[model samples]
Target: MSTSSEHTFTSPFRNFSREEWKRLNGQLSHSIREEDLDQLHALNEPLTMQEIEEVYIPLAHLLELHISKFQELHASSNEFFKRNHQKLPFIIGIAGSVAVGKSTTARVLKKVLALLPSKPKVELVTTDGFLYPNKELIKRDILNRKGFPESYDTKKILRFLADIKSGKSQVTVPLYSHLEYDVLPNEKLVISQPDVLIVEGINVLQVNSRKNGVFVSDFFDYSIYVDADEKNIVSWYINRFESLRATAFQNSASYFHKYANLTTEESLAMAINIWNEINKPNLHQNILPTRYRADLILKKSAQHFVKRIKVRKI
Candidate 1:
């Protein structure tokens, strides 16, 4: 179910040379529709052609390779299993810190992979869909730690994954509305079996296998972690919070109404406070600890773009 190519760069990082990076910058670009990327809240900073080439562009091309190989191997395995058993969907996990630009990475990868000749039907199912409804979090008194691994209905997520993997062509997943800050029970997003399934969120890979723990990550053909310094991520988080406040918070349904009305200084201060008190702590405790579990790691700089990549030597 695997084929080894003699490409000089085995992964994104090792393969990017000065000349090749420049060439990739000019040669490769996803057929990214502006509408498809409108959901991405950050990482759309006006970067130079060099920044696109040296960082985002190469990563785009690298993801293309990772996704193509993933589909090829998964299809072969599914066919083999069909001879004697049932088959399942190919799952993938994307995890990282609060402001590490993982969301943008996932969206970009989804766009890029979908454009792959072999995987036009790829599906990107985010764990945001699995977040427990706000009422449940408030009742449980864990409302403040909303993005922590414990904040989700992991069991439901496992069952959803299992259903898709069991060859259910289509499965329904809960939908989370950022405007309301909760999972909307009445709203369900249907996920069809796709050539590649990209599951992106803050904590998609934590599993307690010793306890027979069921996790979405356990079903993945591969996993990725986006990394950057804590300080840089904090800054990025604050910036994104401001951007969202100005944009999404303008809607009447935004749960952060109190935050939305704050003065510029007050809003900035509150954003940093939330970052330090909640999101950063979650990163240090729940998210960062899972770095070692990633099949590949994309390390980004303070500008929120990748600088180095570490792929587990298969």
Candidate 2:
């Protein structure tokens, strides 16, 4: 129940102030442009160029180092085996609460990493794609629990990661449409063997509750948790809902079209209701507990700018 700032810990993470973190960006060239930010920003979530330079540039550099290290380790293992082995993509897991802007972090990292000198291929996939189809959820009467872990096909996701780590040439994942708010039947995203793959979702950091089970994060070489105060996240979620009401929800085919014509007051009421009933409960019960599992934590200010970072101490 304690706020992020109020919570004290004797954990392995070392906290760095924003200024301290920025100093780590030394001599790293900024390759991201305004257009890139525009594309990466989620609804009602604006990312400033300064924030990207100060926060994400350094993050990209750190990831680059991890990728390089992973490659070297893989090569050493292959040499020890005296056999040629295919290089597998370095998987990065990004997790956070519902409105914490993890997707933007993932997309920005993908673009920046691709532009690095190595020109490594980077593909981004979201756990949303692994959610069971709406029809299946309805059939199971778990439609209200759509974003919960139980609603996801974890076995399938595990198999997908297994194939990727096994050096499969091509892997296909189901595509989920935000506009439709459902998994598109028969549509899949094809990911060729890449140098890096970023998986973003609200629950990516969660460990299986059952003992003696593996977690999706076990496959990740590095992981990030985008974090913010619960109050700020609730506000952001309402703002995003309002924005979607005016935009995507206006489409007749949109899943939330019923809310398109709602008055501002009504929209706000509904947003608050959804947050209290679903998102907040989910965050406290499932998401926040897993925050400690991440290799890096990007803690955000009320304005959504990353104010500090907590890196897991080696």
Candidate 3:
């Protein structure tokens, strides 16, 4: 593992106003239309088009812009070195706290980016696949901290990214099960020559892969951190838990089947317990610390609508 202290960003960013965002990303928003809003099961509630225009659509354009700029940089470098050219992979990382609508953002981004004629082949691989199996987490006495950075196979994730970024024709990403609460056997997602790769997780931009080690983010061409207040995120988490109690958790195969039998009061308490005991702490110590490291931060409100956007100033 190498320290990220040695790595540096390649461009500047600005916190644009809604009007400014429209001017800069308007063309992209039109070019890459996100007609169907993907469902983020964790959201606990239904989504609206307001979220799409204000948050996801603008985000798609911003991402598309960066991808093109990064591609140009590749060509620029090739010309500068007087070498034959090839298309370098463009990687985009989307990071956020638990229940912050990041999964939905990732899904919508995947669909929207695929709309681009210039870069129709986009791949999305979640960090969920990198999570340690339930048995491993239990052995390590960290099952409660599943979404924390330490729960992921960071080294393997880095290797996968490095391989694909290096122009390897095929890269296989593991699959994880929501019902079993572990990585699935004999199930993997394969990617090849992707024009854009969207990596979504709670700590994608966190630089501390180890005390001193290279982060998976080192390979990202751009990054977005979905953010909201602690109270709001906690509320969302609780609501989601209750919703799942009536839906997914009711499945007999669900590891959280016990939650389905709980009263609304009990379910809320359990969700908050999980948050306070595990998710919130992970956010404070590991995830939120990386927010500033992202190329852009999409700030949301209590209602889950994106309220503001912060782009890192060069």
Candidate 4:
């Protein structure tokens, strides 16, 4: 028998094959250029216009439908209360294993959703900014557990989400640098009442016990979990590490610059070790457990193309 991780299309989700999903694209055309896509995707992940047409077009339409409904409901609530409050930004949370392309998904969605007829102001932020600084992690001795749930400042994250949800203006979020592998000092992203906000991170869907019973996923209007086999994810992680070694790691300022001069075999071994010791266990223990919690799951093939979509049934 297949396990839950196998995603055999059990209850609560309506599963669609790639062909079925693509048929829902329904003549929608986007103006995204090839050069624009190059800047959107992550290293080692290739996103083509064809994939955008087949997968993201329909997905964007679906989100617009949800957004429209949300607007209607908000107006109705205001009518009932005889009060007109500012509309809160719709928050979307995207979660998946590292190197599984969740960032690419979030970026593409942000672009597509913003280009819709409504032309709503859309913004994207990653929860990496919420992680404790490397210094604090080292002080706490959880630097090795960087991506784990405990490494994040949950209280601060909750406050940020709460502020945004309350329709606060000019909320500031910390900035993190992938090149330096740390939260940048004194730099922040200021959000000012955007129409939509996309929060992407592996830990977005995580639900550890809290005193006030608030969780990060609680603020999400919609959530997506990028899904793939553990073996495929492991392969992708290794390949990404190898690619980084040749590129980003060679930079003197890169945190992993020490691995830049390693031989091919040595680099491969190091990638395997990091995946086995760090990313793999975190996937199984923290990330994978939250998969089903997502409202939608974008299941991908070994080639990194989305092959199937499972959307929660209303």
Candidate 5:
């Protein structure tokens, strides 16, 4: 692994080696049990207890520090205005390439943050839910570009974030199903006011100029970008695809059921093709470019453990 000192002059972040980062854990204690980790782990991406202690515990503690500061700022602003103000959720955006484990990171943070002494309500939502339905994608003839920025319902996502940031009491988000591989019709996830909201997706860090206005990252209080070498991420994606083929794709109604009967060789070939044709291009063109926008970046090793953390310099 390269040392942070090597990149100090060029990088926007002050990189911390794993050992240096772990020491930041200090006296903080976590309640993340093995069972909690089991549920949070994504397909083919397992997080060990040691990794959780070293990486996530310190990250969560940093978040608590940010949240406390935000609360104090909010209170001071209210005092200056001489008006009673409602507390809005502190929004956190998590972005990364497909199969880089952003989902697992989001789930872990939600669970860990909820267990904090504050015991504040926490909610997790994925931008996958804001993707246009399969029908809409087919109509646009962009089904092959499903994860690209153009394939998302960007306007709707902006509105949703706007509503949340405006302190709406309740907001409803569409639901997406991985097995069905599309947005579920007429299904919605309603989120009431929460103390913290984690929005995870490939494009959460992307900034767009809308005809209405610029929206998206402006609403985020903090953001994270999970990162790894492209080769490593591709390997993880292929492994995950194989795992899904053996499990979810085995279901008769699974959208990817056709892959279940493929020979091991055929499965690996198809996964590689999917990576080359779709996922890889999407990561390079859309996802990777937005990584520098994140407040922090979690760089992973080939084994999928976070080897270093890059905190944007103040």
Candidate 6:
């Protein structure tokens, strides 16, 4: 991969500058609108049409090619077996640190993929739902390590992926509420047949040992990692937390409602403490180690804009 500051010939990834990657878009055009941007972007993260056209549109095109190849392979396998069967949804996993804007990428990619020529039905699900509820986390005494790999229900996540890949007609996933900071009891996300399923979360790319050695990433057709410097990500996290304190946290029902009343100095101190105590350690120990496991990596600038992309060699 060649970036402005680095070049390597034997790396597993081929790096592309933003301009080079944008050229891959060719004649492709997106259907994203202004209002769509409002709904797609994460709080305190800036996503411009330029970013979509240059970064995500090209990414969507690449995924479309991958999806086509995936379908062809499935059909070939079916013919080889002398059997006819429905093709499972192509699952794409997006992973990154807490404030790296992976959610925006997943949401934007889903919108773009759906608007493709085939108009395939694309569904987005975050692994947050698979996280143990707050009560369960407290019971396990890992509430402070919420985003760590151990905080997730590995067994349930593996089962969910297995069911989707098996072409199940109906499968349900638990629903997680960010405002409440918990997995809602009895609420679920019903996933029917989708042409594409995007699973986004910080833990998606982690290597895990399950029964028979099946990993959560085993079911993914493609995976992406959003990357940035630790200092930049820490800044972004603090910024998002401060923004939430002014908005969502102001609500009485918000899990972090108490933070809304904090003075600027107090909020800054608290955000830093949370990052140092929880997020920073998790990033270094778990998330950063999985970056190489992704098929593609979006390396972002300090401003949270993806400046370069690294694609794993075929």
Please, what are the lDDT tens digits per residue for candidate 3 over residues 1-314?
Answer: 87786686555556666555544443332443233443432445456665555566667776777878888888898899998656767888999898888887777678667765464688888999998888899999988788877788888898898898778889999998988778997899999888988999887887776434677888898888988898888888888888788999999999899788999888878988888898888889998999888888877778776767888774
Clashes of each: 2, 0, 1, 0, 0, 1
- Which numbered prediction scores highest in lDDT against the true structure? 4
Candidate 5 structure quality by residue, lDDT tens digits, 1-314 = 99989887677789999999999984444466777778998988879889878998889889999999998999898899997779989999999999999999999888878877788899999998989899999999999999888889988988998899888999999999998999998899999999999999998877652426665788899999999998899899989999888999999999999999999899999999999999988888888989999999999999999999999987
| lDDT winner between candidates 1 and 5 | 5
Residue 44, candidate 5: alpha-carbon lDDT: 83
lDDT of each: 0.71, 0.88, 0.79, 0.91, 0.89, 0.91
Give the runs in model 6 whose Cα sits over 4 Å from its true position: 1-9, 209-211
RMSD of 3: 6.1
Give per-residue lDDT, candidate 6, residue 108: 91
Question: TM-score of each candidate?
Answer: 0.81, 0.94, 0.87, 0.95, 0.94, 0.95
Deviating ranges (above 4 Å) for candidate 3: 1-13, 17-20, 23-35, 38-42, 79-85, 117-119
Candidate 2 lDDT tens digits, 19-124: 9999998344446667777898887788888887888878888888899999999999999999798999999999999989998888888877887778899999
In candidate 4, which residue ranges exceed 4 Å CA deviation?
1-10, 27-30, 209-211
Ranking by lDDT, best first?
Answer: 4, 6, 5, 2, 3, 1
Least accurate 10 contiguous residues by lDDT in model 5: 206-215
Measured on C-alpha atoms, candidate 6 has an lDDT of: 0.91
Query: Which residue pairs in model 5 clash with each other?
Result: none
Error of 6 at 77 (Å): 0.5
Q: After superposition, how far is residue 110 of candidate 2 from its true place, in Å?
A: 0.7
